[model samples]
Target: MTESYLLGIDVGGTSIKMAIFSNDGDLMEKWSIATNKEKDGEYILEDISVSVKEKWQEMDLQANQFIGAGVGVPGFVDIEHGTIDFAVNIGWRDYPISSILSQHLGLPVVVDNDANLAAAGEYWRGAGVDAEDLILLTLGTGVGGGIIVKGDILHGVAGMAGEIGHVTMIPEAGSPCNCGKSGCLETVASATGMVRMARETIEHNTNSRLYQIWQENGEITTKDIFACAENNDTEAVTIINNAMYYLGLATANIANVLNPEKIVIGGGVSGAGEDLLRPLRFYYDTYALPKVKEHSTFAVAELGNDAGVAGAAWAAKTKAK
Candidate 1:
C-alpha cells in the first residue's frame, strides 16, 4: 500500500512556502519561492502549480498518493466561499482562490487567513500542543492574531474572528492604521510600530544611543532599536517597554474574553527573546484578571516560519478525518 500525503502552501506577501506531509503529520519535504504579488492572481497560481508538480515529479510520486492541498493566504478570506476578500500588501481583492486552484490542480483545496493557520499549527504541533485553548500573536510588520478554542480555529460569523491587531489600545495616540483607526494595537506593538516609536524617541531624546545608530544607518529600524536594547540603551529599552505595555493590555483583554491556556508570540521581533517576553509577561500579569492569568502562560512560538505550512497540512488532514 502506498502512503497518503498532504500538500500545504503558505502564501505570504514576500514568499510562498510549500510542504508535503504524511498522513501521520510528519513533514516529508518543503521549499519556498518568492511571490510576485504585482502579477495577476492567475499568474501566481500558475507558478505554484508548476512548482508543486515539479516537486511531485522529483519525488517519483504518483498524484493518487496525494490527499489534498491546503493554503494559508495573507488576506481577509471567506473560508466557506474560498475567496480572498482583500490582501492590501499583495493588492489582491476578491480573488476566487479555491475555484481557480482546484481547476488547475484537480484536487480539493482549503483556504484561510495565514495567521489563523499559524495559530492552528502551534495549537496542533507547537507550543500549544498540550493545551485545549490558545492564542497566537505574530509581531511582524503588523501584529496578527489567531484564536484557537477547544482544539479548533474559531471562525466567527464573517470568518474574521481573530483580528486582534485592530483592537483599540489607545483612544487618541499614535498614527492611524490602515484600518483607519488611531492608536490601534498594531500601530503601537508591531515591528513597524516599534520603529515609529523609536523614531519619535530619537527626535525627542538626543542623548540616546539609538540616535547615534540611526544617524549611522541613515534611518532607524526595528533591528537597530532591538540591538540598542540588547546593549542596555535606556531609550531603546523604554521604547520596547512602551510597546510591551500595549501588547500586555491587548493580551489581558483577550484573556478576559477567551481565557486561553497559552498565548504564543512569534515573528521576527520575538527573536529578542527575554528582552521582549519578560516585559510582555509583566504587563499581561498586571492587567489580566488574576484568575485568567493563573490559567494562561506566555511562550515563544516553536515552529517559526514553518507554522503556516505545517498548519495548512494539519488542517487538510483534519478535514479529511
Candidate 2:
C-alpha cells in the first residue's frame, strides 16, 4: 500500500522546522531553515511552501501522498478563523496563515500556537505519553506553555489559555515583562530572568564562585548557574533556587486547579536536568497541596527540537478526521 504523509511545520522566531511523517506519526525526514522575517514576515509562508515542495520532490513523493499540513505559530492564534490574532515578534496581525499556506501547498492546513503544539507533542510521543492530562512548560529565552485536558489542547475561549509565562508571580514593583506586565513568572523562571538575577546578586556574593565566574566572563548563563549551584556555589544556588521557586509556585497553583498527571519541562534551561529539577521539586512540594504534589509527577521533555514538528504532524492527522 502506498503510504500517506503529513507535513509538519514549526515556525519559530529564529528558524522554521519542517518534517515529513507517516500518518501514524513516524518521522520520515526533517530539516530546518532560517526564518526570514523581512518585510513584516511576508516571506515566511512562501519560504515554507517552497521548501516543502522541494523536499517532497527530493523524496520522490507526489502531492496526493500528503493528507494535510499542520503549522505551529509562536503567537496568539484565532483557531476558529485560521488566522494569527497578533504576533509581535513576527509582526503579524489579522493574518490568514492557514488559508495562505493551504493555497500554496494544495493541501488542507491546520494551525495552532507553537507552545500548545509542543505540549501536545509531548503528550503524544514524549514524556507525557501515558497521561491523559498534562502541562508542558518550555523555558527558553522566554517561557511558554500548553495545557492538555483529557487529551485535547485547551485553548480556552480566546485561544490564550496556556500563557503560563505571563502569570503574575510578583504584583508589586516587580520587573517589567514583554507582555507589559510586572512580575510575570517569565520574569523569574526564564533564562532571561535567571541571568538577570545572577547579575543582580553577583555583587553581593563577590567572594563566591558565581561572582568569580561573572568577573571572568562578564556574564553568566543558566547553565553556569546550575553547574555552580551543583558544586555548592552560594550565589548560583540562590539564583537557581529563587527562579525555580517562582516556577514551582506557578505550576503548583495551576496544578492545584488542574491536577494534571504529569508536568513536562523542556527548553534550553531544562538541559540542566537534575540540577534544575531538584530545587524546582522542592519548591513545588512547598507550594502545592499535599495530594496534588503527591499525585502529579514532573518530567523532562524527550523530543528536543523534534517536538513542535511531531505535535504539528499529530494536529494534521486530527484535521484529517
Candidate 3:
C-alpha cells in the first residue's frame, strides 16, 4: 500500500507556490514557479497541472496515492462551480480552475480565494490554530483578508465576504483604490497605500528622516516607513499611526459582528511584529464594542508565505474527508 498525500497550490500574481503534504498534514515538499500571465493567463492552469505531474514523478509516488488537490487563487472565486469570477492580477475572468485541474490531475480539486485560504491555514496550523473562529488580514501590496466562523469560511451571498480591504475609510478627500473606489481601507492601510501616504507627506516635510532615506534609496517602502518609525522619525510615526487607525477601524467592525477568538495579521507589513501589533491593538480596542474588545485577541500570523499552501492543503484534506 502506498502512502497518501495532498497537493496544495497557491496562485499569486507573480508566482505559483505548490506543496505536497502527508495525509496527516505534515509538509513533505514545496516549490514555486513563475506565473505565465501571457495570453490572458490561459496557460496558468496547464502549467500547474504539468508541474504537479512532474513533482509526482520526481517523488516516485503512485497516481492513486494523492487523495486530492486544493488551490488558492487571487480573485473572487465561486466555490460552487470552482470558477474564478475575476482576478485582475492574473487576467482571469470566469476561469474554470477547479474543473480543469481536477481533469488534468485525476483528483478532486477545491478552489477558493487566496486570502480565504490564508485564513484557513492560520486557523488550522498557524497563529489561530485551535480557535473555532478567526480572521486573517494580509497587509501587503494590497490589503486582503478572510473570515472564518465556527471552522468554516464565511462566503457571503456574492462570495465576496471578508473583503475588509474595500471597507470605506475616508469617504471624502481620500485616495483612490484599485477597486475603483475612493477612501477604501486599502488606500491607506496597504503597503502601496502607505507608500503613497509617505510620498505625500515628504512633499511638505522634507526635513524628516524619512525624506532623507527616500532621497538616498530613491524609493520608499512599507518596510522603510516602519523602520524609520521605530527610530522615532516624526513623519514615519505619523504615517504609520494614520494607517493603523483605518486598519483598526475595519478590523474592529468585523470583530463586532463575528466576535472571533483570534485576529491574525499577516503579509510583509506584519513583519514589524510588536511595533505593528501594539498600536493596531490600541486602535482596535478603541473602536471595537465592549464584548468584542474583551473576547478577541490579536496575533501576528505565523505561516507567512506558506499560509496559502498550507491552507490549500487543509482544504483538500477536508474536502476529501
Candidate 4:
C-alpha cells in the first residue's frame, strides 16, 4: 500500500518551479531550479530531470511510488503530441518536451500552456474552486489568460484559446506589441503596459506625482502608479481607470458570451489587490449584460505563484485517472 506522488513542473524564462503532491491533492514539497537557457535551452529539461531524481533519492522514494509528471510550458504547445511550437523566452522551437521529459524521468508526462495550468490550478484549489466555469487572468509583464468551461480548460484547436493579451483592444494608433501587432490588449493591461502608460502620462503631464517620482527614482513602477492613484493623483487615477476600462471591457465581452461563473485575476499587477479589481469591476458591470453580470463574480487569485505547479499536478493526476 505505497502512497503515490505527482510531480508538477512549471517552466519559466529564468527559473523552473517544481512541486510534489500526494494523490489526494496535498502539496508535499516544492522547490525551484535555475533554468539553464544556454545552447537554446537545450539543457533545461536535463537539469529538471537531474534535480527531480536527486530530490526523489534524498526523500528515499521509490520510482514506482510516483504516478507521473506534468509540465506547464511557457508557449504554444501541441498537447496531444506534447510538442512545443515555440517559446521565445526560453528559445525552444518545435521541441518535443513531453516525450523528452518522459524518457528522462521514465514516467508519463502531460504538457500544456502555462496559462492553462494557472487556470486549472485556480479552478481546483484557488479562487475558482467549486466553479464549473471560470477564467483566470495573469497580468504580468505580458497579460496571459486561461478559460475553463464546464470544469475543463478550453484549449482551442490551435492550442491558442485563451490569449486574451493578444486580443486587439485598439486597432488604431496603438503601441506596438511584441507579438508584432499594434494595439493588442497586452499593451494596456499588463505590468509593462502600466509602466508604459505611466511614462507616457509623465511625459505629457509634468506636474503629476508619478512624474515627480520618476524624476526622483529615474523610473516608475506599477506599484508607484497604484500608490499614486490611492493618494488620488489625478493622472495616476486616470491611467488606472483607463487600463481597467479596457481590461474590463475585454473580460465582459468574454463573459457576455461564455458567462463563466467566476473571473479570477492573478499575476504581479494583481498585487494591487482591491485597487485593481474595484475599478475593473466598475467597468465590467458597465459592459456585462445584466443577467451575466449578476451571475458572474470577479475576485483576486488566491494561489499566487503556486497556481502553475498546482495546475500541473492536477493535469498529471487527471490524466493518470
Candidate 5:
C-alpha cells in the first residue's frame, strides 16, 4: 500500500509557500518562492505548478501519490465557485483560482481565505486543539481573523465571515484604516497601528527612552517599540498598553458574540510575548462578559508560519474524504 500525500499552498503578498504532508499530518517537505502579485495570477499558478512538479521529481514520487491540493489566499473567495472575489493587498479580483490551478496541475484544489485556513490549522493541530469552538486573531502588517464553530470554518455569506479586523472598535477617534473606517480594530491593534502610536508618543514625550532609541535609529517600528518596552521604556509600554486595550475590546466583542471556547493570537506583533499578552489579558478580563470570559482561555499561537500550510493540507485531506 502506498502512502497518500497532500500539497498545501499558502499565498502571501510577497511569497508563495508550499508544503507536502502525509495523510496523517506529518510534514514531508516545504519550500517557498517569491510572489509578484503585480504580475498575472496565472503566472503565479504556473510557478506553483512548476515548483510542485520539481518537488515531486526530487522526492522520486509520482503525481498519483498525492490526494489533492489546498490553497489559502490572502483575499475574499467565493468558495462555492472557487473564485477569488477580491484581494486589495494582492490586487486580485474575481480570479478563477481553483479552476485555473486544477486545470494547470491536473489535480483537485480547494481555495479559502488565508486567515480562515490559519484558524483551521490552529483548531486542528495548534493552540485550539483542545477547543471545539475557536477564534484566531492574526496581527501582522494588517490584522486578519478566523472563526471556527463546532470544528468547522464559518464562511458567512460572501465568505467574509472572519473579518474581525475591520470591525469598528472606535468610531470617532484615531487614524483612519484602509477599510475606509475610522478607528477599526486594525487601526489600533495591528503592527501598523503600533507604529502610528509610537510616532505619536515620541512627539509628545521626548524624555522617554523610546525617543532616545528613535533618535539613534531615526525611525521606530513596532519591533523596536517592543524591544524598548522590554527595556522598561515608559513610552513603549504605554503604546503597547494602548494597543492592547483595543485588542481586548475587540476580543471581548468577539467573545460576547461568538462565545468561543478559546481565543488564539498570532502573527508578528504577538512576538512581544508577555509584554502584549499581560496587558491584553487584563483588558479582556475587564471587558468580557463573565460567562464567556470564564469559558474562553486566551493564548499565543504555537504553529507560527507553518499554520497555513499545515491547515491547508488538513483541509485538502478532509475534503478528499
Candidate 6:
C-alpha cells in the first residue's frame, strides 16, 4: 500500500511556506516560495501550484499519493464559502482561494484564517497539545489572536471571533490603532505598541536609558525596552508592566467565559521568555477568578515559524477524514 502524504501551505504577504507531512503528523519536507504580488496578488496561488508540482516531481511522488492541500490564508476567511472576505495585505476580496487552489493543484483544498491555523497548530502539536480549549496571542509588528474551543478552531459568524488584538483596552483617550479603533490591545501590547510606549516615555523623562537609546538611534525596539527594564529602568519597567496588565485583563476576561486549558503566547515578543511570562502571569493572577485561574495554565508556543504550516497540514488531514 502506498503511503499517504499531506500538503500544507501558509500564504503570507511576502512569501508562501509549504510543507509535506506524513499521515501520522511527522513533517517530511518544508520550503518556501516568494509570494508574487503582481496584479494585486492575482498570481500568488498559481505560483504555489507550480512550486508544489515541481516539489512533488523532485521527490518522485505521484499526485495520487497525496490526500489534499490545506492553506492558511492571512485575512478574514469565510470558511463556509471558502473565500477570503477581505485581506488588505494580500489584496484579495471575497476571493475563492479554496476552489481555486483545488483546481490548480488537482486536490481538494481547505482554507482557514492564518492566525487560527497557528493556534490550531499549537493545540495539535505545540504548547496547547492535549488541551481541549486554548487561546493564542501572537505579538509581532501587530498582534494576532486565535481561540480553540473543544479541539476546534472557533470561526464566528463573520469569521472575526478571536481578534484579541482589536479588543478594546483603553476605550477613551487611548492611542489610535490600525484597525481604526482607539486604545486596542494591539496598540498597547504589539511590538509597534511597545515602541509607541517607549516614545511616550522618552518624551516625559529624557534622562532614562530608554530615552538615551531612542535619541541616539532615532528609534527604540521592544528588545531595547526589555533590556532597559532588565537594568531596572523605572520607565521601561512601567511600560512593560502596563502592556502586560492589559493582556492579563483580557486573558482573565476570556478565561472567565471560556475557561481554556491553557493560554499560549507566541511571536517575537515571546522571545523575552521568562521576562514576559513572569509579568504576564502576575497580572493574570491578579485579575482572573480563582476557579478559572486554577484550571487555565500558561505556556509558550513550541513551534516557531512552523506553526502555520503545521496547522495547515492538520486542516487537510482533518478534512480528509
Best by lDDT: 4
Error at 57, model 6, angstroms: 1.1
TM-scores for the candidates = 0.95, 0.96, 0.96, 0.97, 0.95, 0.97
User: Listing every candidate in turn, what is its Cα RMSD in Å to the true structure after a full C-alpha superposition?
Assistant: 1.6, 1.4, 1.4, 1.2, 1.6, 1.2
Residue 113 local lDDT, model 1: 90
- lDDT per residue for candidate 1 within 9-45, as digits (tens), equals 9998789999998887788999998888666454788
CA displacement after TM-score superposition, residue 69 of candidate 1 (Å)? 0.8
Q: How does residue 288 of candidate 3 score in lDDT? A: 97
Could you tell me how far off, in angstroms, the CA of residue 12 lies in candidate 4 after the best superposition?
Answer: 0.6
Q: Looking at model 4, report the run of 10 residues with the lowest lDDT sum.
A: 60-69
On a 0 to 100 scale, what is the lDDT of residue 23 in model 1?
82
Write the residue-wise lDDT of candidate 4 on 1-321 in tens digits. Answer: 464899999999989999998987889999999988999999999999999999999888755788888899899999889899999889999999988999898888999999999999999889999888999999989999999999988998999999999989998999999999989899999989989999988888898899899999998989999999899999899999989999999999989989999999999999999999999999999999999999999889998999999999989888743
| Per-model CA lDDT versus the true structure | 0.87, 0.90, 0.91, 0.92, 0.87, 0.89
Q: Which ten residues in a row have the lowest lDDT in candidate 1?
A: 37-46
Whole-structure CA lDDT of model 6? 0.89
Residue 88 miss distance in model 3 (angstroms): 1.5
Model 2, residue 156: C-alpha shift (Å): 0.8
Of the two candidates 2 and 4, the one with more favorable TM-score, higher being better, is 4
- Candidate closer to the true structure by TM-score (higher is better), 3 or 4: 4
